[model samples]
Target: MSVVPGLVSITFRQLGVGEILALLRRTGLEAVEWGGDVHVPVGDVAAAKRTAAATADHGVRVAAYGSYYRAGDHAPADFDAVLRTAVALGAPRIRIWAGAAGSADLTTQQRAGVVGDVRRITELAAGEGVEIAVEHHPGTLTDTLDSALALYAEVGHPGLRPYWQPRLGLGPAEAVHEAGALLPGLVTVHVFSWTADGVRLALADGAPLWQPVLGTVAGASAEAGAERYALLEFVQDDDPEALVRDAVTLRSWLGGG
Candidate 1:
């Protein structure tokens, strides 16, 4: 699979849909992952369709539907709507949170519940021709790479994949090592740069980390038979112009610049 640079709409959620599309186009990025919050709310089929149409008109791919559907956090009754929204949005995958509790803090029953919920959701998404990918984020079961692998192993579903990012607290080498370990199940990536203290930095500042991570994923995608994307999720202080530099940096990392 070919790796490409794209934008996650949530980073610029304050902007209108047309403005977001224009920003994406001007940056020469190839795709977008539309967030369910603000950009395309859940259960809003009409809005999703319209956004999908607008994105296509500008010749950009809807990489995935960035849904906030936490597996163990939301009501089971609500998942069908999320799946339907993804289908309407023309997204091949739906990005979701692993569970409400972090892996380290989960009880025995809680772990089982999270695993069962994710497995159920994966099957549900499969029926709709959409894939389920858990977000690698804090306060979720996949907060760390080991837990991410464990979650996938326990769920034991081929349809379940993970969306990885540079884990905040780890150094570049450690982060790359962790990312490499999750290569087998990684489907999407949220790209950004931040210090150990959580201060947002320029994407280019994370080059040492992103370069090897992207290279590893690019090779994995080629053998895995699907396209993978390193989406620019956040820029310095939500600045739009920073995206211009981020786009160039992303292209360079992907060897397209």
Candidate 2:
């Protein structure tokens, strides 16, 4: 693997198709990941097709399709559909989640089920040169890094990877620390901007965190075998330019373009 500058794969959930394509070009970012529930539902093939086409036309690379797949929910067919669309669109990564959080009964079966489905998807995606990366998201299944990693460990599938997030309601230090530790399983890192105690003008303005974040990324890069993409998934009501700035500063801090 080359020393990639941590490409920013923005989520298309908050932004529309056209706007997203335009933003990727304007920002000069190549990789993109999808969050089906956040934008176009994964089950909707028509919309997924349109989305896949648009990304291709604009010269944006589809890093992954973030799908809402519950470990307990045996829906490999559903994932197959999404993967088909993604493969057509040229995505090389697929993001799946752990079982839904707060469920009354959390069993090993739930974990095993997701592992099996993910392994199957990984095999299918590998044929298309895609990777199935598990994400650590908040307010959902496997919100924390530890729990998500446990499933990943138990599953013991080389294909099941991780997409790390710093702000799953954890402190900056904790978030950054966990993110650094999970580098081997990491595919990308979500970027966020912040003010001292309030909102900044935009996502670009979230430079405060970059100084420390770069350290985490650098250390992780050394630990991990390759330089994986440090993806920026900034969703703020503020200016999108700030979002780009947030991304740029992060790359710059990490010695990127």
Candidate 3:
């Protein structure tokens, strides 16, 4: 019923599974969302299982499978592979992109295509007891809060959830608003700090923005009687030490320190 502090494995994509797990043990992060693009590729059941075992050995849980299954871009059969990988990895949820195109760039039919695919994948994942989380990112239908809410409404399936992050250049007030708006269906948050121009900064440097946003997310999670994660991603300079420092800052914000 509280927000958990965790990491997105792709933050250290260059590291092997063993190395990443070892790093997790040092950071005190409670969970990891393994990236399908690298650490746990789709259909790689052997790798998924091995990583899951290693994650458990390191005393961390699999938060979700960070899959690159862009809905509407691929055939429906493709999601089956993603779902299988997530199940093998013991991930309760699979994170997917809404679509490859930006929201405004998509026509009505294209938007419908994405929505239809999302609905299909949601049902497929639910059949396996896994949920689907749409990544709230640019160059996708979820680029804006209203667009994201609308997409969810169209799907209208309990199996579909959302992952939120502070959009580039968004101020604290706007970020807080977006987080609050997504709270009802938010599954996890990709935590990071970036300048308006996309320069990664230390997590502590973004405290003014993150503090209230995290507070809002925590409140919503408690109210919904559900646990969610604030997962760290893309630290300054892609440095493991930066991740460790970010973890400390995140834990303090979550009252875990």
Among the numbered candidates, top lDDT falls to: 3
Top candidate by TM-score: 3
Model 1 scores worst on lDDT over the 10 consecutive residues at 166-175
Show model 3 residue runs off by greater than 4 Å. none
What are the per-residue Cα lDDT tens digits for candidate 2 across 155-249?
67677778776553356677667766676667676666545454533545545455565566666676666666666654455456755665566
lDDT of 3 by residue, 1-257 (tens): 29998899899989998888888889889999999998999999999999888889889999999999999998888988899999999999999999999999999999999999999999999999999999999999999989999999999999999899988889999999898888688888899999999999999999989999999999988888889999999899999999989999999999999
Model 1 residue runs over 4 Å out of place are 223-225
TM-scores of all candidate predictions against the true structure: 0.96, 0.76, 0.98
> Each candidate: how many clashes?
2, 4, 0
| Local accuracy of candidate 1 as per-residue lDDT tens digits, 201-222 | 8888887788888888898877
* Candidate 3 RMSD to the real structure: 0.9
The TM-score between candidate 1 and the true structure equals 0.96
